[model samples]
Target: MAIVTSKVAGHAPGQPRGGVVQMARDSWVVARRNLRRMTRIPEIVVFGLMQPVMFVLLFSYVMGGAIKVPGGGYREFLMAGIFTQTVAFAVEGASAGIADDMTKGLVDRFRSLPMARSAVLAGRTLADVVQSAFILLVLAMVALLVGWRVHQGILKALSAFLLLLLLGYAFSWIGALIGLSLRSPEAATSAGLIWLFPLTFLSNAFVPVNTMPGWLQAIAYWNPFSATVQACRKLFGNPGVDGAHAWPMQHPVAASTLWSLLILALFSWLSVRKYRNAVG
Candidate 1:
Protein backbone atom coordinates (compact mmCIF):
# COMPACT_ATOMS: atom_id res chain seq x y z
CA MET A 1 0.00 0.00 0.00
CA ALA A 2 2.86 2.38 0.88
CA ILE A 3 4.62 1.58 -2.46
CA VAL A 4 1.48 2.19 -4.42
CA THR A 5 0.93 5.47 -2.62
CA SER A 6 4.56 6.43 -3.15
CA LYS A 7 4.33 5.72 -6.87
CA VAL A 8 1.07 7.60 -7.13
CA ALA A 9 2.57 10.59 -5.36
CA GLY A 10 5.57 10.60 -7.73
CA HIS A 11 7.97 9.45 -5.05
CA ALA A 12 9.01 6.13 -6.57
CA PRO A 13 12.69 6.25 -5.74
CA GLY A 14 15.18 4.42 -7.96
CA GLN A 15 12.53 3.44 -10.51
CA PRO A 16 13.71 4.11 -14.03
CA ARG A 17 11.24 5.91 -16.29
CA GLY A 18 10.85 4.76 -19.89
CA GLY A 19 8.81 7.77 -20.95
CA VAL A 20 11.36 9.07 -23.43
CA VAL A 21 12.04 5.73 -25.01
CA GLN A 22 8.39 4.83 -25.20
CA MET A 23 7.50 8.19 -26.64
CA ALA A 24 10.17 7.82 -29.32
CA ARG A 25 9.00 4.37 -30.25
CA ASP A 26 5.41 5.54 -30.41
CA SER A 27 6.37 8.56 -32.49
CA TRP A 28 8.22 6.41 -35.01
CA VAL A 29 5.26 4.11 -35.37
CA VAL A 30 3.00 7.07 -36.08
CA ALA A 31 5.50 8.49 -38.54
CA ARG A 32 5.70 5.24 -40.43
CA ARG A 33 1.93 5.05 -40.59
CA ASN A 34 1.83 8.48 -42.17
CA LEU A 35 4.63 7.59 -44.61
CA ARG A 36 2.83 4.43 -45.72
CA ARG A 37 -0.31 6.42 -46.30
CA MET A 38 1.61 8.84 -48.50
CA THR A 39 3.01 5.98 -50.50
CA ARG A 40 -0.46 4.55 -51.06
CA ILE A 41 -1.58 7.91 -52.39
CA PRO A 42 0.97 8.24 -55.15
CA GLU A 43 -0.56 11.44 -56.48
CA ILE A 44 0.36 13.25 -53.28
CA VAL A 45 4.07 12.81 -53.90
CA VAL A 46 3.70 13.45 -57.63
CA PHE A 47 1.83 16.68 -57.09
CA GLY A 48 4.24 17.89 -54.44
CA LEU A 49 7.16 17.31 -56.79
CA MET A 50 5.38 18.87 -59.75
CA GLN A 51 4.59 22.21 -58.07
CA PRO A 52 8.17 23.01 -57.12
CA VAL A 53 9.50 21.70 -60.40
CA MET A 54 7.08 23.91 -62.23
CA PHE A 55 8.22 26.90 -60.25
CA VAL A 56 11.82 26.09 -61.05
CA LEU A 57 11.23 25.72 -64.78
CA LEU A 58 8.94 28.72 -65.12
CA PHE A 59 11.17 30.99 -63.07
CA SER A 60 14.30 29.81 -64.80
CA TYR A 61 13.30 30.22 -68.42
CA VAL A 62 10.55 32.83 -68.42
CA MET A 63 12.23 35.00 -65.85
CA GLY A 64 15.70 34.25 -67.13
CA GLY A 65 17.58 37.53 -67.44
CA ALA A 66 14.46 39.31 -66.26
CA ILE A 67 15.91 39.59 -62.78
CA LYS A 68 19.63 40.20 -62.46
CA VAL A 69 21.80 39.63 -59.41
CA PRO A 70 24.92 41.77 -59.39
CA GLY A 71 27.47 39.03 -58.76
CA GLY A 72 26.05 35.64 -59.74
CA GLY A 73 23.76 33.73 -62.04
CA TYR A 74 20.17 34.60 -61.21
CA ARG A 75 19.35 30.92 -61.70
CA GLU A 76 21.77 29.89 -58.94
CA PHE A 77 20.37 32.50 -56.59
CA LEU A 78 16.81 31.55 -57.48
CA MET A 79 17.37 27.90 -56.53
CA ALA A 80 18.01 28.71 -52.87
CA GLY A 81 14.92 30.89 -52.74
CA ILE A 82 12.78 28.35 -54.54
CA PHE A 83 14.16 25.56 -52.38
CA THR A 84 13.37 27.44 -49.20
CA GLN A 85 9.88 28.22 -50.47
CA THR A 86 9.23 24.57 -51.33
CA VAL A 87 10.21 23.25 -47.92
CA ALA A 88 8.39 26.01 -46.10
CA PHE A 89 5.34 24.95 -48.08
CA ALA A 90 5.35 21.72 -46.07
CA VAL A 91 3.45 23.53 -43.34
CA GLU A 92 0.34 23.50 -45.56
CA GLY A 93 0.59 19.78 -46.14
CA ALA A 94 1.05 19.08 -42.46
CA SER A 95 -2.00 21.16 -41.62
CA ALA A 96 -4.18 19.45 -44.19
CA GLY A 97 -3.09 15.96 -43.13
CA ILE A 98 -3.69 16.59 -39.46
CA ALA A 99 -7.00 18.26 -40.16
CA ASP A 100 -8.09 15.28 -42.28
CA ASP A 101 -7.10 12.85 -39.56
CA MET A 102 -9.06 14.80 -36.98
CA THR A 103 -12.12 15.08 -39.19
CA LYS A 104 -12.08 11.36 -39.96
CA GLY A 105 -11.69 10.39 -36.27
CA LEU A 106 -8.18 9.02 -36.74
CA VAL A 107 -6.88 11.19 -33.97
CA ASP A 108 -9.66 9.99 -31.72
CA ARG A 109 -8.53 6.43 -32.29
CA PHE A 110 -4.95 7.39 -31.44
CA ARG A 111 -6.13 9.15 -28.34
CA SER A 112 -7.85 6.04 -27.11
CA LEU A 113 -4.68 4.02 -27.56
CA PRO A 114 -1.70 3.59 -25.23
CA MET A 115 0.60 5.79 -27.26
CA ALA A 116 2.20 8.96 -25.97
CA ARG A 117 0.13 12.10 -25.98
CA SER A 118 2.71 13.73 -28.23
CA ALA A 119 2.94 10.88 -30.69
CA VAL A 120 0.37 12.21 -33.11
CA LEU A 121 1.83 15.67 -33.56
CA ALA A 122 5.42 14.47 -33.39
CA GLY A 123 4.73 11.76 -35.92
CA ARG A 124 2.99 14.14 -38.30
CA THR A 125 5.84 16.62 -38.16
CA LEU A 126 8.44 13.92 -38.67
CA ALA A 127 6.62 12.63 -41.71
CA ASP A 128 6.51 16.16 -43.11
CA VAL A 129 10.27 16.43 -42.74
CA VAL A 130 10.77 13.23 -44.71
CA GLN A 131 8.35 14.34 -47.39
CA SER A 132 10.07 17.70 -47.57
CA ALA A 133 13.44 16.01 -48.04
CA PHE A 134 12.18 13.86 -50.88
CA ILE A 135 10.67 16.90 -52.57
CA LEU A 136 13.88 18.86 -52.13
CA LEU A 137 15.87 16.10 -53.79
CA VAL A 138 13.68 16.16 -56.86
CA LEU A 139 13.65 19.96 -56.93
CA ALA A 140 17.43 20.09 -56.71
CA MET A 141 17.71 17.93 -59.78
CA VAL A 142 15.42 20.28 -61.64
CA ALA A 143 17.54 23.16 -60.43
CA LEU A 144 20.69 21.55 -61.82
CA LEU A 145 19.15 21.00 -65.21
CA VAL A 146 18.22 24.68 -65.30
CA GLY A 147 21.81 25.97 -64.88
CA TRP A 148 21.82 26.42 -61.11
CA ARG A 149 25.23 25.20 -59.93
CA VAL A 150 26.51 24.89 -56.39
CA HIS A 151 29.92 26.49 -56.31
CA GLN A 152 30.56 25.68 -52.70
CA GLY A 153 31.99 22.29 -51.84
CA ILE A 154 29.60 19.35 -51.60
CA LEU A 155 29.68 19.47 -47.78
CA LYS A 156 28.67 23.13 -47.57
CA ALA A 157 25.93 22.65 -50.14
CA LEU A 158 24.69 19.73 -48.06
CA SER A 159 24.68 21.84 -44.90
CA ALA A 160 22.43 24.39 -46.62
CA PHE A 161 20.01 21.68 -47.60
CA LEU A 162 20.00 20.34 -44.06
CA LEU A 163 19.14 23.81 -42.73
CA LEU A 164 16.22 24.01 -45.15
CA LEU A 165 14.93 20.68 -43.83
CA LEU A 166 15.29 21.98 -40.32
CA LEU A 167 13.22 24.99 -41.27
CA GLY A 168 10.55 22.69 -42.73
CA TYR A 169 10.44 20.63 -39.56
CA ALA A 170 10.14 23.76 -37.47
CA PHE A 171 7.32 25.18 -39.55
CA SER A 172 5.46 21.86 -39.47
CA TRP A 173 4.97 22.35 -35.74
CA ILE A 174 3.16 25.57 -36.49
CA GLY A 175 1.04 23.63 -38.95
CA ALA A 176 0.21 21.10 -36.26
CA LEU A 177 -1.00 23.88 -34.04
CA ILE A 178 -3.02 25.39 -36.88
CA GLY A 179 -4.60 22.07 -37.81
CA LEU A 180 -5.60 21.37 -34.25
CA SER A 181 -7.13 24.78 -33.91
CA LEU A 182 -9.19 24.53 -37.11
CA ARG A 183 -12.26 22.29 -37.60
CA SER A 184 -11.79 21.19 -41.21
CA PRO A 185 -9.01 20.37 -43.67
CA GLU A 186 -10.13 23.05 -46.08
CA ALA A 187 -10.04 25.70 -43.41
CA ALA A 188 -6.68 24.43 -42.20
CA THR A 189 -5.24 24.54 -45.69
CA SER A 190 -6.41 28.11 -46.21
CA ALA A 191 -5.23 29.20 -42.77
CA GLY A 192 -1.92 27.43 -43.31
CA LEU A 193 -1.13 29.37 -46.51
CA ILE A 194 -2.56 32.72 -45.42
CA TRP A 195 0.60 33.70 -43.58
CA LEU A 196 3.03 31.90 -45.83
CA PHE A 197 2.38 34.20 -48.78
CA PRO A 198 3.57 37.17 -46.76
CA LEU A 199 6.31 35.19 -45.03
CA THR A 200 7.76 34.01 -48.33
CA PHE A 201 6.98 37.00 -50.54
CA LEU A 202 8.03 39.66 -48.07
CA SER A 203 11.38 38.00 -47.68
CA ASN A 204 14.50 38.09 -49.87
CA ALA A 205 13.71 34.76 -51.49
CA PHE A 206 13.19 35.78 -55.12
CA VAL A 207 14.66 39.26 -55.08
CA PRO A 208 17.52 41.04 -53.36
CA VAL A 209 16.60 42.70 -50.10
CA ASN A 210 18.49 45.77 -51.19
CA THR A 211 16.11 46.15 -54.08
CA MET A 212 13.11 46.61 -51.81
CA PRO A 213 12.20 49.99 -50.37
CA GLY A 214 13.87 50.96 -47.10
CA TRP A 215 10.93 49.96 -44.86
CA LEU A 216 10.21 46.73 -46.72
CA GLN A 217 13.88 45.89 -46.85
CA ALA A 218 14.01 45.86 -43.06
CA ILE A 219 11.22 43.32 -42.87
CA ALA A 220 12.72 41.19 -45.58
CA TYR A 221 16.14 41.19 -43.98
CA TRP A 222 14.77 40.26 -40.60
CA ASN A 223 12.47 37.55 -41.93
CA PRO A 224 13.35 34.01 -40.88
CA PHE A 225 12.85 32.94 -44.46
CA SER A 226 15.36 35.51 -45.63
CA ALA A 227 17.89 34.27 -43.12
CA THR A 228 17.72 30.77 -44.55
CA VAL A 229 17.85 32.01 -48.14
CA GLN A 230 20.89 34.15 -47.47
CA ALA A 231 22.54 31.31 -45.60
CA CYS A 232 21.95 28.96 -48.50
CA ARG A 233 23.30 31.44 -51.00
CA LYS A 234 26.48 31.84 -49.00
CA LEU A 235 26.84 28.11 -48.51
CA PHE A 236 26.29 27.46 -52.19
CA GLY A 237 28.55 30.37 -53.15
CA ASN A 238 25.77 31.96 -55.14
CA PRO A 239 25.15 35.63 -55.92
CA GLY A 240 23.14 38.29 -54.00
CA VAL A 241 24.48 37.20 -50.63
CA ASP A 242 26.71 40.18 -49.96
CA GLY A 243 24.47 43.23 -50.37
CA ALA A 244 22.63 42.98 -47.08
CA HIS A 245 24.29 44.38 -43.94
CA ALA A 246 21.76 43.22 -41.35
CA TRP A 247 22.84 40.82 -38.64
CA PRO A 248 20.84 37.95 -40.14
CA MET A 249 22.17 38.48 -43.63
CA GLN A 250 25.73 39.09 -42.42
CA HIS A 251 25.79 35.89 -40.39
CA PRO A 252 23.04 33.95 -42.08
CA VAL A 253 24.07 30.46 -41.08
CA ALA A 254 23.83 31.32 -37.41
CA ALA A 255 20.64 33.27 -37.88
CA SER A 256 19.03 30.53 -39.90
CA THR A 257 19.92 27.91 -37.31
CA LEU A 258 18.69 30.11 -34.48
CA TRP A 259 15.46 30.94 -36.29
CA SER A 260 14.73 27.32 -37.10
CA LEU A 261 15.51 26.14 -33.59
CA LEU A 262 13.47 28.93 -32.03
CA ILE A 263 10.46 28.17 -34.22
CA LEU A 264 10.79 24.46 -33.48
CA ALA A 265 10.89 25.03 -29.71
CA LEU A 266 8.03 27.53 -29.49
CA PHE A 267 5.68 25.70 -31.84
CA SER A 268 6.59 22.26 -30.52
CA TRP A 269 5.52 23.27 -27.02
CA LEU A 270 2.37 24.95 -28.35
CA SER A 271 1.53 22.01 -30.58
CA VAL A 272 1.89 19.45 -27.80
CA ARG A 273 -0.29 21.56 -25.51
CA LYS A 274 -2.82 22.02 -28.29
CA TYR A 275 -2.85 18.29 -28.91
CA ARG A 276 -3.62 17.60 -25.24
CA ASN A 277 -6.49 20.07 -25.22
CA ALA A 278 -7.74 18.68 -28.53
CA VAL A 279 -7.93 15.18 -27.12
CA GLY A 280 -8.80 16.10 -23.57
Candidate 2:
Protein backbone atom coordinates (compact mmCIF):
# COMPACT_ATOMS: atom_id res chain seq x y z
CA MET A 1 0.00 0.00 0.00
CA ALA A 2 2.85 2.43 0.87
CA ILE A 3 4.64 1.72 -2.43
CA VAL A 4 1.52 2.21 -4.45
CA THR A 5 0.82 5.50 -2.72
CA SER A 6 4.37 6.72 -3.31
CA LYS A 7 4.18 5.79 -7.04
CA VAL A 8 0.88 7.65 -7.36
CA ALA A 9 2.42 10.74 -5.75
CA GLY A 10 5.40 10.61 -8.09
CA HIS A 11 3.12 10.38 -11.11
CA ALA A 12 1.37 13.61 -10.18
CA PRO A 13 4.21 15.87 -11.35
CA GLY A 14 4.34 13.96 -14.62
CA GLN A 15 1.08 15.57 -15.57
CA PRO A 16 1.33 18.84 -17.50
CA ARG A 17 2.54 21.83 -15.53
CA GLY A 18 0.28 24.85 -15.68
CA GLY A 19 2.53 27.63 -14.51
CA VAL A 20 3.96 30.77 -16.13
CA VAL A 21 7.27 29.28 -17.21
CA GLN A 22 5.66 26.27 -18.79
CA MET A 23 3.12 28.50 -20.45
CA ALA A 24 5.84 30.75 -21.84
CA ARG A 25 7.80 27.79 -23.17
CA ASP A 26 4.74 26.30 -24.75
CA SER A 27 3.74 29.62 -26.26
CA TRP A 28 7.16 30.08 -27.81
CA VAL A 29 6.99 26.66 -29.41
CA VAL A 30 3.49 27.35 -30.71
CA ALA A 31 4.48 30.75 -32.10
CA ARG A 32 7.41 29.17 -33.96
CA ARG A 33 5.14 26.52 -35.40
CA ASN A 34 2.69 29.17 -36.54
CA LEU A 35 5.44 31.25 -38.14
CA ARG A 36 6.64 28.24 -40.05
CA ARG A 37 3.15 27.52 -41.25
CA MET A 38 2.88 31.11 -42.45
CA THR A 39 6.14 30.69 -44.32
CA ARG A 40 5.01 27.50 -46.00
CA ILE A 41 1.77 29.09 -47.07
CA PRO A 42 2.53 32.58 -48.28
CA GLU A 43 -1.04 32.80 -49.40
CA ILE A 44 -1.94 33.60 -45.84
CA VAL A 45 -0.04 36.88 -46.11
CA VAL A 46 -1.44 37.57 -49.54
CA PHE A 47 -4.98 37.12 -48.37
CA GLY A 48 -4.48 39.49 -45.46
CA LEU A 49 -2.82 41.96 -47.80
CA MET A 50 -5.65 41.87 -50.26
CA GLN A 51 -8.60 42.14 -47.87
CA PRO A 52 -7.95 45.72 -46.67
CA VAL A 53 -7.04 46.93 -50.14
CA MET A 54 -10.23 45.56 -51.60
CA PHE A 55 -12.28 47.07 -48.79
CA VAL A 56 -10.68 50.49 -49.22
CA LEU A 57 -11.08 50.37 -52.96
CA LEU A 58 -14.61 49.08 -52.87
CA PHE A 59 -15.69 51.72 -50.41
CA SER A 60 -13.62 54.64 -51.69
CA TYR A 61 -14.44 54.41 -55.37
CA VAL A 62 -17.56 52.29 -55.40
CA MET A 63 -19.35 53.58 -52.32
CA GLY A 64 -17.45 56.75 -51.49
CA GLY A 65 -19.32 58.99 -53.90
CA ALA A 66 -22.62 57.46 -52.91
CA ILE A 67 -22.13 57.73 -49.16
CA LYS A 68 -22.58 61.22 -47.70
CA VAL A 69 -20.33 61.94 -44.73
CA PRO A 70 -21.23 64.94 -42.60
CA GLY A 71 -17.93 66.63 -41.75
CA GLY A 72 -15.58 65.44 -44.46
CA GLY A 73 -15.64 64.30 -48.08
CA TYR A 74 -16.31 60.68 -48.98
CA ARG A 75 -12.65 59.60 -48.97
CA GLU A 76 -12.14 61.17 -45.58
CA PHE A 77 -15.37 59.73 -44.26
CA LEU A 78 -14.59 56.34 -45.77
CA MET A 79 -11.24 56.12 -43.96
CA ALA A 80 -12.68 55.55 -40.49
CA GLY A 81 -15.16 52.97 -41.72
CA ILE A 82 -12.54 51.16 -43.75
CA PHE A 83 -10.18 50.91 -40.80
CA THR A 84 -12.91 49.49 -38.61
CA GLN A 85 -13.85 46.91 -41.22
CA THR A 86 -10.25 45.98 -41.88
CA VAL A 87 -9.55 45.17 -38.26
CA ALA A 88 -12.80 43.29 -38.01
CA PHE A 89 -11.58 41.06 -40.81
CA ALA A 90 -8.55 40.01 -38.77
CA VAL A 91 -10.79 37.48 -37.10
CA GLU A 92 -11.12 35.71 -40.40
CA GLY A 93 -7.49 34.59 -40.31
CA ALA A 94 -7.58 33.74 -36.63
CA SER A 95 -10.73 31.65 -36.82
CA ALA A 96 -9.78 30.02 -40.09
CA GLY A 97 -6.32 29.06 -38.84
CA ILE A 98 -7.61 27.54 -35.63
CA ALA A 99 -10.38 25.67 -37.43
CA ASP A 100 -7.93 24.39 -40.00
CA ASP A 101 -5.68 23.05 -37.28
CA MET A 102 -8.63 21.44 -35.61
CA THR A 103 -9.73 19.88 -38.90
CA LYS A 104 -6.24 18.46 -39.50
CA GLY A 105 -6.44 16.91 -36.02
CA LEU A 106 -3.40 18.94 -35.05
CA VAL A 107 -5.22 20.48 -32.11
CA ASP A 108 -6.21 17.03 -30.85
CA ARG A 109 -2.62 15.91 -31.17
CA PHE A 110 -1.55 18.92 -29.14
CA ARG A 111 -4.03 17.98 -26.48
CA SER A 112 -2.63 14.49 -26.28
CA LEU A 113 0.83 15.87 -25.67
CA PRO A 114 2.04 16.87 -22.19
CA MET A 115 3.00 20.45 -23.00
CA ALA A 116 1.80 23.77 -21.61
CA ARG A 117 -1.80 23.77 -22.76
CA SER A 118 -2.08 27.54 -22.98
CA ALA A 119 0.80 27.76 -25.41
CA VAL A 120 -1.32 26.92 -28.43
CA LEU A 121 -3.66 29.84 -27.87
CA ALA A 122 -0.87 32.21 -26.87
CA GLY A 123 1.18 31.43 -29.96
CA ARG A 124 -1.74 31.66 -32.31
CA THR A 125 -2.92 34.91 -30.74
CA LEU A 126 0.50 36.48 -30.95
CA ALA A 127 0.75 35.49 -34.59
CA ASP A 128 -2.64 37.00 -35.18
CA VAL A 129 -1.45 40.30 -33.71
CA VAL A 130 1.60 40.32 -35.95
CA GLN A 131 -0.48 39.56 -38.98
CA SER A 132 -3.03 42.19 -38.05
CA ALA A 133 -0.32 44.78 -37.59
CA PHE A 134 1.05 44.00 -41.03
CA ILE A 135 -2.35 44.32 -42.55
CA LEU A 136 -2.88 47.64 -40.78
CA LEU A 137 0.38 48.95 -42.20
CA VAL A 138 -0.76 48.01 -45.68
CA LEU A 139 -4.08 49.69 -45.13
CA ALA A 140 -2.43 52.81 -43.74
CA MET A 141 -0.36 53.14 -46.92
CA VAL A 142 -3.45 52.75 -49.02
CA ALA A 143 -5.29 55.27 -46.89
CA LEU A 144 -2.50 57.71 -47.54
CA LEU A 145 -2.75 57.19 -51.27
CA VAL A 146 -6.50 57.62 -51.21
CA GLY A 147 -6.25 60.99 -49.37
CA TRP A 148 -6.98 59.83 -45.84
CA ARG A 149 -4.63 61.83 -43.67
CA VAL A 150 -4.02 61.44 -39.94
CA HIS A 151 -3.93 64.94 -38.46
CA GLN A 152 -3.16 63.81 -34.91
CA GLY A 153 0.56 64.24 -35.45
CA ILE A 154 3.04 61.36 -35.42
CA LEU A 155 2.87 60.61 -31.68
CA LYS A 156 -0.88 60.54 -31.46
CA ALA A 157 -1.12 58.61 -34.70
CA LEU A 158 1.26 55.95 -33.39
CA SER A 159 -0.71 55.66 -30.17
CA ALA A 160 -3.95 55.33 -32.10
CA PHE A 161 -2.40 52.62 -34.24
CA LEU A 162 -1.37 50.68 -31.14
CA LEU A 163 -4.85 50.97 -29.71
CA LEU A 164 -6.32 49.69 -32.96
CA LEU A 165 -3.87 46.78 -32.97
CA LEU A 166 -4.84 45.93 -29.41
CA LEU A 167 -8.46 45.98 -30.47
CA GLY A 168 -7.68 43.57 -33.30
CA TYR A 169 -5.84 41.32 -30.85
CA ALA A 170 -8.88 41.23 -28.63
CA PHE A 171 -11.09 40.20 -31.54
CA SER A 172 -8.58 37.53 -32.49
CA TRP A 173 -9.31 35.84 -29.20
CA ILE A 174 -12.97 35.83 -30.13
CA GLY A 175 -11.94 34.16 -33.34
CA ALA A 176 -9.91 31.61 -31.44
CA LEU A 177 -12.86 30.84 -29.22
CA ILE A 178 -15.16 30.42 -32.21
CA GLY A 179 -12.58 28.29 -33.97
CA LEU A 180 -12.26 25.86 -31.09
CA SER A 181 -15.97 25.70 -30.37
CA LEU A 182 -17.05 25.20 -33.98
CA ARG A 183 -16.72 21.89 -35.82
CA SER A 184 -15.74 22.95 -39.31
CA PRO A 185 -13.53 25.60 -40.96
CA GLU A 186 -16.37 26.58 -43.26
CA ALA A 187 -18.65 26.94 -40.30
CA ALA A 188 -16.13 29.11 -38.49
CA THR A 189 -15.68 31.29 -41.58
CA SER A 190 -19.38 31.73 -41.99
CA ALA A 191 -19.89 32.52 -38.33
CA GLY A 192 -17.03 35.03 -38.31
CA LEU A 193 -18.17 36.99 -41.39
CA ILE A 194 -21.76 36.99 -40.26
CA TRP A 195 -20.65 38.60 -37.05
CA LEU A 196 -18.26 40.97 -38.81
CA PHE A 197 -20.55 42.26 -41.55
CA PRO A 198 -23.26 43.47 -39.24
CA LEU A 199 -20.98 44.81 -36.50
CA THR A 200 -19.00 46.99 -38.90
CA PHE A 201 -21.64 48.40 -41.26
CA LEU A 202 -24.08 49.24 -38.51
CA SER A 203 -21.55 51.44 -36.74
CA ASN A 204 -20.45 55.06 -37.36
CA ALA A 205 -17.43 53.73 -39.17
CA PHE A 206 -18.55 54.98 -42.59
CA VAL A 207 -21.92 56.71 -42.39
CA PRO A 208 -23.09 58.59 -39.33
CA VAL A 209 -25.51 56.70 -37.11
CA ASN A 210 -27.90 59.67 -37.38
CA THR A 211 -28.33 58.73 -41.01
CA MET A 212 -29.52 55.30 -39.95
CA PRO A 213 -33.10 54.69 -38.88
CA GLY A 214 -33.89 55.70 -35.30
CA TRP A 215 -33.49 52.13 -34.01
CA LEU A 216 -30.37 51.43 -36.03
CA GLN A 217 -28.99 54.78 -34.96
CA ALA A 218 -29.28 53.72 -31.35
CA ILE A 219 -27.63 50.40 -32.03
CA ALA A 220 -24.86 52.01 -34.06
CA TYR A 221 -24.19 54.63 -31.43
CA TRP A 222 -23.61 51.98 -28.79
CA ASN A 223 -21.76 49.54 -31.00
CA PRO A 224 -18.15 49.07 -29.95
CA PHE A 225 -17.16 49.44 -33.58
CA SER A 226 -18.61 52.94 -33.63
CA ALA A 227 -16.79 53.83 -30.47
CA THR A 228 -13.52 52.73 -32.00
CA VAL A 229 -14.22 54.62 -35.18
CA GLN A 230 -15.31 57.74 -33.38
CA ALA A 231 -12.25 57.57 -31.17
CA CYS A 232 -9.98 57.03 -34.16
CA ARG A 233 -11.54 59.92 -35.99
CA LYS A 234 -10.83 62.14 -33.02
CA LEU A 235 -7.26 60.96 -32.96
CA PHE A 236 -7.02 61.72 -36.66
CA GLY A 237 -8.34 65.23 -35.95
CA ASN A 238 -11.16 64.71 -38.38
CA PRO A 239 -13.92 67.30 -38.39
CA GLY A 240 -17.06 66.35 -36.53
CA VAL A 241 -20.64 67.35 -37.35
CA ASP A 242 -23.13 67.11 -34.51
CA GLY A 243 -26.31 65.09 -35.04
CA ALA A 244 -24.28 63.12 -37.51
CA HIS A 245 -21.66 60.84 -35.92
CA ALA A 246 -23.25 61.04 -32.41
CA TRP A 247 -21.60 59.39 -29.36
CA PRO A 248 -18.03 60.58 -29.26
CA MET A 249 -20.10 63.58 -30.20
CA GLN A 250 -17.17 65.20 -28.39
CA HIS A 251 -13.93 63.26 -27.71
CA PRO A 252 -14.64 60.16 -29.68
CA VAL A 253 -11.00 59.18 -29.54
CA ALA A 254 -10.86 58.68 -25.80
CA ALA A 255 -14.25 56.99 -25.57
CA SER A 256 -13.54 54.64 -28.43
CA THR A 257 -10.13 53.68 -27.03
CA LEU A 258 -11.51 52.96 -23.56
CA TRP A 259 -14.18 50.70 -24.98
CA SER A 260 -11.57 48.85 -27.02
CA LEU A 261 -9.42 48.15 -23.97
CA LEU A 262 -12.40 46.89 -22.03
CA ILE A 263 -13.31 44.57 -24.88
CA LEU A 264 -9.74 43.29 -25.18
CA ALA A 265 -9.71 42.36 -21.52
CA LEU A 266 -13.05 40.60 -21.70
CA PHE A 267 -12.29 38.61 -24.83
CA SER A 268 -8.77 37.67 -23.68
CA TRP A 269 -10.12 36.22 -20.44
CA LEU A 270 -12.82 34.33 -22.29
CA SER A 271 -10.43 32.91 -24.88
CA VAL A 272 -7.89 31.82 -22.26
CA ARG A 273 -10.53 30.07 -20.17
CA LYS A 274 -12.05 28.35 -23.18
CA TYR A 275 -8.63 27.27 -24.43
CA ARG A 276 -7.63 25.76 -21.09
CA ASN A 277 -10.89 23.83 -20.89
CA ALA A 278 -10.54 22.57 -24.44
CA VAL A 279 -6.99 21.39 -23.80
CA GLY A 280 -7.85 19.87 -20.44
- The TM-score of predicted model 2 comes to 0.85
lDDT agreement of model 2 with the native: 0.76
lDDT leader: 1
lDDT of 1: 0.89
Q: What is the C-alpha RMSD of each candidate to the true structure, in Å?
A: 5.8, 5.4
lDDT of 2 by residue, 241-270 (tens): 335445455656666677767876887677
The digit string of per-residue lDDT tens for model 1 on 112-146 reads 77678898999999999999999999888888888
What's the CA RMSD of model 2 in angstroms? 5.4
TM-score of 1: 0.92
Runs of candidate 2 with Cα error greater than 4 angstroms are 1-18, 240-251
